[model samples]
Target: MRLTRHTDYALRILLQAAVEPERRLSIAEVAEAQGIARNHAMKLVNELAGAGLLATVRGRGGGFALGRPAGEIGIGEVVRLTEPDLRPADCENCALSPGCGLTPMLSGAVRAFLAELDRFTLADAAKGTRVPLLIPT
Candidate 1:
Protein backbone atom coordinates (compact mmCIF):
# COMPACT_ATOMS: atom_id res chain seq x y z
CA MET A 1 0.00 0.00 0.00
CA ARG A 2 1.12 3.54 -0.73
CA LEU A 3 1.88 5.72 2.27
CA THR A 4 0.53 9.25 2.45
CA ARG A 5 2.79 12.31 2.19
CA HIS A 6 2.52 12.86 5.94
CA THR A 7 3.88 9.41 6.61
CA ASP A 8 6.54 9.91 3.96
CA TYR A 9 7.75 13.11 5.61
CA ALA A 10 7.70 11.44 8.99
CA LEU A 11 9.91 8.69 7.63
CA ARG A 12 12.25 11.22 6.11
CA ILE A 13 12.57 13.03 9.44
CA LEU A 14 13.30 9.85 11.35
CA LEU A 15 15.73 8.73 8.67
CA GLN A 16 17.45 12.08 8.88
CA ALA A 17 17.77 11.73 12.64
CA ALA A 18 19.08 8.21 12.25
CA VAL A 19 21.68 9.35 9.76
CA GLU A 20 22.81 12.22 11.94
CA PRO A 21 22.66 11.01 15.52
CA GLU A 22 25.53 13.17 16.78
CA ARG A 23 23.60 16.43 17.06
CA ARG A 24 20.02 17.59 17.20
CA LEU A 25 18.51 18.72 13.89
CA SER A 26 16.12 21.53 13.18
CA ILE A 27 13.00 21.20 11.06
CA ALA A 28 14.35 23.77 8.64
CA GLU A 29 17.44 21.69 7.99
CA VAL A 30 15.39 18.60 7.43
CA ALA A 31 13.04 20.42 5.06
CA GLU A 32 15.87 21.93 3.05
CA ALA A 33 17.75 18.68 2.83
CA GLN A 34 14.74 16.69 1.72
CA GLY A 35 13.38 19.44 -0.52
CA ILE A 36 10.19 19.52 1.54
CA ALA A 37 8.44 22.47 3.11
CA ARG A 38 9.68 23.63 6.52
CA ASN A 39 6.11 23.83 7.75
CA HIS A 40 5.47 20.31 6.54
CA ALA A 41 8.60 19.04 8.25
CA MET A 42 7.61 20.87 11.44
CA LYS A 43 4.24 19.16 11.47
CA LEU A 44 5.87 15.83 10.72
CA VAL A 45 8.42 16.42 13.47
CA ASN A 46 5.65 17.17 15.95
CA GLU A 47 3.82 14.05 14.93
CA LEU A 48 6.95 11.92 15.16
CA ALA A 49 7.77 13.37 18.56
CA GLY A 50 4.24 12.60 19.76
CA ALA A 51 4.62 8.99 18.60
CA GLY A 52 7.86 8.56 20.57
CA LEU A 53 9.83 8.31 17.37
CA LEU A 54 11.79 11.44 18.20
CA ALA A 55 12.41 13.77 21.13
CA THR A 56 12.20 17.53 20.92
CA VAL A 57 13.99 20.09 22.99
CA ARG A 58 12.91 23.69 23.57
CA GLY A 59 14.81 27.01 23.95
CA ARG A 60 18.24 27.87 22.54
CA GLY A 61 20.15 25.06 20.80
CA GLY A 62 16.90 23.05 20.84
CA GLY A 63 16.17 20.56 18.11
CA PHE A 64 15.03 16.98 17.50
CA ALA A 65 16.61 13.56 17.96
CA LEU A 66 15.57 9.95 18.11
CA GLY A 67 13.54 8.95 21.14
CA ARG A 68 15.42 5.67 21.12
CA PRO A 69 18.34 4.20 19.21
CA ALA A 70 17.95 3.84 15.47
CA GLY A 71 18.18 0.05 15.60
CA GLU A 72 15.52 -0.04 18.30
CA ILE A 73 12.99 1.84 16.25
CA GLY A 74 10.97 -0.38 13.91
CA ILE A 75 9.49 0.99 10.72
CA GLY A 76 6.26 -0.94 11.24
CA GLU A 77 5.81 0.71 14.61
CA VAL A 78 6.41 4.08 13.02
CA VAL A 79 3.90 3.37 10.28
CA ARG A 80 1.37 2.19 12.82
CA LEU A 81 1.88 5.34 14.87
CA THR A 82 1.98 7.79 11.95
CA GLU A 83 -0.31 6.23 9.43
CA PRO A 84 -3.75 7.82 9.80
CA ASP A 85 -5.50 4.48 9.23
CA LEU A 86 -4.08 0.97 9.07
CA ARG A 87 -6.99 -0.56 7.31
CA PRO A 88 -6.33 -1.39 3.67
CA ALA A 89 -9.96 -0.70 3.08
CA ASP A 90 -12.86 0.08 5.34
CA CYS A 91 -13.91 -3.45 6.17
CA GLU A 92 -16.64 -1.57 8.02
CA ASN A 93 -18.01 -0.28 4.74
CA CYS A 94 -17.21 -3.62 3.25
CA ALA A 95 -19.70 -6.44 3.74
CA LEU A 96 -16.76 -8.83 4.10
CA SER A 97 -15.68 -8.46 7.72
CA PRO A 98 -17.89 -11.17 9.21
CA GLY A 99 -17.18 -13.80 6.57
CA CYS A 100 -15.94 -13.27 3.08
CA GLY A 101 -13.26 -15.18 1.17
CA LEU A 102 -11.88 -11.94 -0.23
CA THR A 103 -11.57 -10.44 3.23
CA PRO A 104 -9.21 -13.13 4.50
CA MET A 105 -6.89 -12.82 1.51
CA LEU A 106 -6.90 -9.05 1.67
CA SER A 107 -6.32 -9.00 5.40
CA GLY A 108 -3.51 -11.48 4.97
CA ALA A 109 -1.91 -9.20 2.43
CA VAL A 110 -2.04 -6.28 4.81
CA ARG A 111 -0.49 -8.40 7.53
CA ALA A 112 2.28 -9.44 5.20
CA PHE A 113 2.93 -5.85 4.31
CA LEU A 114 3.26 -4.96 7.97
CA ALA A 115 5.53 -7.93 8.55
CA GLU A 116 7.87 -6.71 5.84
CA LEU A 117 8.00 -3.29 7.40
CA ASP A 118 8.74 -4.86 10.78
CA ARG A 119 11.94 -6.40 9.43
CA PHE A 120 13.58 -3.00 8.97
CA THR A 121 15.00 -0.63 11.59
CA LEU A 122 15.54 3.10 11.42
CA ALA A 123 19.20 2.29 10.85
CA ASP A 124 18.28 0.22 7.84
CA ALA A 125 16.37 3.17 6.49
CA ALA A 126 19.27 5.48 7.26
CA LYS A 127 21.81 3.32 5.50
CA GLY A 128 19.52 2.35 2.70
CA THR A 129 19.84 5.72 1.07
CA ARG A 130 22.63 6.11 -1.48
CA VAL A 131 23.75 9.46 -0.11
CA PRO A 132 22.35 10.59 3.18
CA LEU A 133 21.56 14.22 3.76
CA LEU A 134 23.51 14.88 6.93
CA ILE A 135 22.55 18.16 8.56
CA PRO A 136 24.63 20.00 11.15
CA THR A 137 23.60 20.03 14.73
Candidate 2:
Protein backbone atom coordinates (compact mmCIF):
# COMPACT_ATOMS: atom_id res chain seq x y z
CA MET A 1 0.00 0.00 0.00
CA ARG A 2 1.20 3.49 -0.77
CA LEU A 3 1.50 5.51 2.39
CA THR A 4 0.15 9.02 2.63
CA ARG A 5 2.64 11.89 2.82
CA HIS A 6 1.50 12.48 6.39
CA THR A 7 2.45 8.96 7.41
CA ASP A 8 5.70 9.23 5.51
CA TYR A 9 6.60 12.44 7.33
CA ALA A 10 5.60 10.94 10.66
CA LEU A 11 7.88 7.98 10.05
CA ARG A 12 10.69 10.30 9.05
CA ILE A 13 10.21 12.27 12.22
CA LEU A 14 10.38 9.10 14.30
CA LEU A 15 13.49 7.97 12.49
CA GLN A 16 15.12 11.31 13.13
CA ALA A 17 14.34 11.05 16.81
CA ALA A 18 15.62 7.47 16.87
CA VAL A 19 18.85 8.57 15.26
CA GLU A 20 19.41 11.29 17.83
CA PRO A 21 18.17 9.78 21.05
CA GLU A 22 20.50 11.73 23.29
CA ARG A 23 19.50 15.14 21.96
CA ARG A 24 16.14 16.85 22.08
CA LEU A 25 15.15 17.94 18.57
CA SER A 26 13.05 20.93 17.56
CA ILE A 27 10.24 21.06 14.99
CA ALA A 28 12.34 23.35 12.82
CA GLU A 29 15.16 20.84 12.82
CA VAL A 30 12.80 18.02 11.90
CA ALA A 31 11.12 20.12 9.21
CA GLU A 32 14.46 21.09 7.70
CA ALA A 33 15.76 17.56 7.84
CA GLN A 34 12.63 16.03 6.36
CA GLY A 35 12.01 18.87 3.93
CA ILE A 36 8.52 19.35 5.38
CA ALA A 37 6.88 22.56 6.55
CA ARG A 38 7.52 23.62 10.15
CA ASN A 39 3.81 23.79 10.93
CA HIS A 40 3.29 20.32 9.52
CA ALA A 41 6.17 19.00 11.58
CA MET A 42 4.79 20.69 14.69
CA LYS A 43 1.36 19.11 14.18
CA LEU A 44 2.83 15.67 13.65
CA VAL A 45 5.11 16.07 16.65
CA ASN A 46 2.22 17.10 18.84
CA GLU A 47 0.16 14.15 17.67
CA LEU A 48 3.05 11.80 18.33
CA ALA A 49 3.62 13.28 21.75
CA GLY A 50 -0.04 12.86 22.60
CA ALA A 51 0.21 9.22 21.66
CA GLY A 52 3.18 8.79 24.02
CA LEU A 53 5.49 8.01 21.14
CA LEU A 54 7.34 11.30 21.69
CA ALA A 55 8.03 13.43 24.73
CA THR A 56 7.84 17.21 24.41
CA VAL A 57 9.16 19.99 26.61
CA ARG A 58 8.06 23.60 26.71
CA GLY A 59 9.73 27.01 27.39
CA ARG A 60 13.26 28.01 26.50
CA GLY A 61 15.59 25.21 25.51
CA GLY A 62 12.55 23.02 24.90
CA GLY A 63 12.36 20.27 22.33
CA PHE A 64 11.31 16.66 21.94
CA ALA A 65 12.70 13.18 22.36
CA LEU A 66 11.48 9.62 22.01
CA GLY A 67 9.09 8.83 24.81
CA ARG A 68 10.33 5.25 24.77
CA PRO A 69 13.21 3.37 23.24
CA ALA A 70 13.39 3.13 19.47
CA GLY A 71 13.27 -0.61 19.69
CA GLU A 72 10.00 -0.35 21.57
CA ILE A 73 8.29 1.65 18.82
CA GLY A 74 6.87 -0.52 16.06
CA ILE A 75 6.78 0.66 12.48
CA GLY A 76 3.33 -0.82 12.03
CA GLU A 77 2.13 1.02 15.11
CA VAL A 78 3.27 4.30 13.64
CA VAL A 79 1.59 3.57 10.33
CA ARG A 80 -1.63 2.62 12.05
CA LEU A 81 -1.59 5.78 14.10
CA THR A 82 -0.87 8.08 11.18
CA GLU A 83 -2.94 6.43 8.48
CA PRO A 84 -6.53 7.61 8.69
CA ASP A 85 -7.74 4.89 6.37
CA LEU A 86 -6.23 1.47 5.70
CA ARG A 87 -8.73 0.15 3.19
CA PRO A 88 -6.94 -0.75 0.04
CA ALA A 89 -9.92 -0.47 -2.25
CA ASP A 90 -13.19 1.42 -2.25
CA CYS A 91 -15.28 -1.68 -2.55
CA GLU A 92 -18.08 0.01 -0.70
CA ASN A 93 -18.88 2.18 -3.69
CA CYS A 94 -18.47 -0.54 -6.30
CA ALA A 95 -21.49 -2.02 -8.08
CA LEU A 96 -20.40 -5.48 -6.98
CA SER A 97 -20.05 -4.46 -3.35
CA PRO A 98 -22.69 -6.93 -2.29
CA GLY A 99 -20.61 -9.99 -3.17
CA CYS A 100 -17.13 -8.85 -4.04
CA GLY A 101 -14.32 -11.28 -3.32
CA LEU A 102 -11.81 -8.52 -3.94
CA THR A 103 -12.73 -6.81 -0.73
CA PRO A 104 -11.60 -9.68 1.47
CA MET A 105 -8.48 -10.15 -0.62
CA LEU A 106 -7.61 -6.48 -0.31
CA SER A 107 -8.27 -6.53 3.41
CA GLY A 108 -6.01 -9.55 3.79
CA ALA A 109 -3.31 -7.79 1.84
CA VAL A 110 -3.47 -4.82 4.18
CA ARG A 111 -3.24 -7.10 7.20
CA ALA A 112 -0.23 -8.87 5.74
CA PHE A 113 1.42 -5.58 4.96
CA LEU A 114 0.92 -4.36 8.49
CA ALA A 115 2.14 -7.69 9.89
CA GLU A 116 5.39 -7.37 7.97
CA LEU A 117 5.87 -3.83 9.19
CA ASP A 118 5.15 -4.98 12.74
CA ARG A 119 8.29 -7.09 12.56
CA PHE A 120 10.47 -4.00 12.33
CA THR A 121 11.00 -1.22 14.85
CA LEU A 122 12.27 2.32 14.62
CA ALA A 123 15.67 1.10 15.80
CA ASP A 124 15.67 -1.48 13.03
CA ALA A 125 15.00 1.20 10.42
CA ALA A 126 17.61 3.55 11.91
CA LYS A 127 20.19 0.84 12.31
CA GLY A 128 23.53 1.53 10.59
CA THR A 129 22.36 5.10 9.94
CA ARG A 130 24.22 8.15 11.20
CA VAL A 131 23.10 11.60 12.24
CA PRO A 132 23.59 12.79 8.68
CA LEU A 133 19.88 12.20 8.14
CA LEU A 134 19.24 15.43 10.01
CA ILE A 135 20.54 18.76 8.77
CA PRO A 136 22.40 21.06 11.13
CA THR A 137 20.62 24.31 12.00
Candidate 3:
Protein backbone atom coordinates (compact mmCIF):
# COMPACT_ATOMS: atom_id res chain seq x y z
CA MET A 1 0.00 0.00 0.00
CA ARG A 2 1.13 3.55 -0.69
CA LEU A 3 1.49 6.17 1.99
CA THR A 4 -0.63 9.31 1.88
CA ARG A 5 0.81 12.67 0.87
CA HIS A 6 0.23 13.96 4.37
CA THR A 7 2.43 11.28 5.87
CA ASP A 8 5.02 11.87 3.19
CA TYR A 9 5.12 15.55 4.06
CA ALA A 10 5.23 14.80 7.75
CA LEU A 11 8.28 12.57 7.27
CA ARG A 12 10.01 15.24 5.25
CA ILE A 13 9.40 17.78 7.97
CA LEU A 14 10.73 15.46 10.63
CA LEU A 15 13.82 14.71 8.60
CA GLN A 16 14.64 18.39 8.15
CA ALA A 17 14.17 19.13 11.82
CA ALA A 18 16.23 16.16 12.86
CA VAL A 19 19.00 17.12 10.51
CA GLU A 20 19.31 20.48 12.18
CA PRO A 21 18.52 19.82 15.79
CA GLU A 22 19.54 23.26 16.99
CA ARG A 23 17.64 25.34 14.51
CA ARG A 24 13.91 25.75 14.52
CA LEU A 25 12.46 25.70 11.03
CA SER A 26 9.44 27.70 10.09
CA ILE A 27 6.57 26.18 8.14
CA ALA A 28 7.25 28.60 5.29
CA GLU A 29 10.82 27.40 5.05
CA VAL A 30 9.79 23.78 5.14
CA ALA A 31 7.14 24.42 2.51
CA GLU A 32 9.63 26.18 0.28
CA ALA A 33 12.22 23.48 0.70
CA GLN A 34 9.80 20.61 0.15
CA GLY A 35 7.89 22.41 -2.64
CA ILE A 36 4.65 21.99 -0.73
CA ALA A 37 1.97 24.57 -0.05
CA ARG A 38 2.41 26.78 2.99
CA ASN A 39 -1.03 25.92 4.35
CA HIS A 40 -0.36 22.25 4.05
CA ALA A 41 2.96 22.59 5.79
CA MET A 42 1.29 24.54 8.55
CA LYS A 43 -1.25 21.80 9.13
CA LEU A 44 1.31 19.01 9.13
CA VAL A 45 3.59 20.95 11.48
CA ASN A 46 0.71 21.38 13.89
CA GLU A 47 -0.02 17.68 13.74
CA LEU A 48 3.61 16.75 14.31
CA ALA A 49 3.87 19.12 17.25
CA GLY A 50 0.63 17.78 18.71
CA ALA A 51 1.91 14.23 18.35
CA GLY A 52 5.01 15.26 20.33
CA LEU A 53 7.40 14.55 17.49
CA LEU A 54 8.03 18.28 17.07
CA ALA A 55 8.31 21.15 19.49
CA THR A 56 7.02 24.58 18.47
CA VAL A 57 8.03 28.04 19.61
CA ARG A 58 5.63 30.92 19.16
CA GLY A 59 6.18 34.56 18.21
CA ARG A 60 9.20 36.21 16.65
CA GLY A 61 12.25 34.07 15.93
CA GLY A 62 10.15 31.01 16.71
CA GLY A 63 9.32 27.95 14.65
CA PHE A 64 9.57 24.16 15.05
CA ALA A 65 12.26 21.76 16.11
CA LEU A 66 12.49 18.10 17.03
CA GLY A 67 10.72 17.44 20.31
CA ARG A 68 12.59 14.24 21.02
CA PRO A 69 15.90 12.93 19.86
CA ALA A 70 15.70 11.54 16.35
CA GLY A 71 16.96 8.18 17.58
CA GLU A 72 14.16 8.03 20.09
CA ILE A 73 11.45 8.40 17.43
CA GLY A 74 10.91 5.29 15.39
CA ILE A 75 9.87 5.53 11.79
CA GLY A 76 7.16 3.00 12.44
CA GLU A 77 5.82 5.13 15.28
CA VAL A 78 5.64 8.11 12.99
CA VAL A 79 3.86 6.09 10.35
CA ARG A 80 1.36 4.88 12.89
CA LEU A 81 0.67 8.41 14.06
CA THR A 82 0.40 9.95 10.59
CA GLU A 83 -1.72 7.20 9.13
CA PRO A 84 -5.34 7.37 10.20
CA ASP A 85 -5.95 3.75 9.30
CA LEU A 86 -3.68 0.81 8.63
CA ARG A 87 -6.28 -1.46 7.10
CA PRO A 88 -4.93 -2.80 3.86
CA ALA A 89 -8.31 -2.93 2.27
CA ASP A 90 -11.80 -1.60 2.77
CA CYS A 91 -13.70 -4.72 3.71
CA GLU A 92 -16.19 -3.32 6.12
CA ASN A 93 -18.81 -2.63 3.46
CA CYS A 94 -17.65 -5.02 0.77
CA ALA A 95 -20.18 -7.53 -0.53
CA LEU A 96 -17.61 -10.34 -0.21
CA SER A 97 -16.22 -9.13 3.09
CA PRO A 98 -17.05 -12.31 4.88
CA GLY A 99 -15.26 -14.58 2.40
CA CYS A 100 -12.53 -12.42 0.93
CA GLY A 101 -9.04 -13.47 1.92
CA LEU A 102 -7.45 -10.46 0.29
CA THR A 103 -7.99 -8.38 3.37
CA PRO A 104 -5.94 -10.64 5.60
CA MET A 105 -3.17 -10.98 3.05
CA LEU A 106 -2.97 -7.25 2.56
CA SER A 107 -3.12 -6.66 6.26
CA GLY A 108 -0.22 -9.03 6.76
CA ALA A 109 1.78 -7.18 4.15
CA VAL A 110 1.13 -3.86 5.84
CA ARG A 111 2.10 -5.33 9.20
CA ALA A 112 5.34 -6.60 7.74
CA PHE A 113 6.08 -3.22 6.21
CA LEU A 114 5.54 -1.45 9.50
CA ALA A 115 7.57 -4.01 11.37
CA GLU A 116 10.47 -3.39 9.03
CA LEU A 117 10.15 0.34 9.54
CA ASP A 118 10.25 -0.20 13.29
CA ARG A 119 13.85 -1.29 12.88
CA PHE A 120 14.84 2.20 11.82
CA THR A 121 14.50 5.58 13.49
CA LEU A 122 14.52 9.16 12.22
CA ALA A 123 18.24 9.30 13.04
CA ASP A 124 18.82 6.36 10.74
CA ALA A 125 16.80 7.94 7.99
CA ALA A 126 18.66 11.25 8.34
CA LYS A 127 22.13 9.80 8.35
CA GLY A 128 22.04 9.18 4.62
CA THR A 129 21.28 12.77 3.54
CA ARG A 130 21.98 14.88 6.57
CA VAL A 131 25.68 15.55 6.14
CA PRO A 132 25.06 18.55 3.93
CA LEU A 133 22.37 19.92 6.20
CA LEU A 134 24.23 19.57 9.46
CA ILE A 135 24.89 22.95 11.10
CA PRO A 136 27.71 21.75 13.35
CA THR A 137 25.44 21.64 16.36
| Residues 13-131 of candidate 2: C-alpha lDDT, one tens digit per residue | 88889989988998998898679999999999999999999999987788999999999999999999999999988888899999988888898999999999999999999998665
Per-residue CA lDDT of model 1 for 70-121, tens digit only, reads: 9999999988887888767777776667776777777899899999999999
**TM-score of the candidate numbered 2?**
0.94
Flag regions of model 1 displaced more than 4 Å: 95-98, 128-137
A best-first ranking of the candidates according to their lDDT comes to 2, 3, 1
Which pairs of residues collide in candidate 2?
none
Candidate 3 lDDT over residue span 74-97, tens digit each = 999999999998887788989998
Q: Report residue 136 deviation for candidate 3 (angstroms).
A: 16
TM-score of each: 0.87, 0.94, 0.90
Which regions of candidate 3 deviate over 4 angstroms?
A: 130-137
Task: State each model's CA lDDT, in order.
Answer: 0.84, 0.91, 0.87
Model 2, CA-based lDDT? 0.91
Give the number of the best model, judged by lDDT.
Answer: 2
lDDT of 1 at 36: 87
Query: Pairs clashing in candidate 3?
Result: none
Query: Candidate 1, after superposition: displacement of residue 63 in Å?
Result: 0.8
- Scored against the true structure, residue 81 in model 2 reaches a CA lDDT of 99
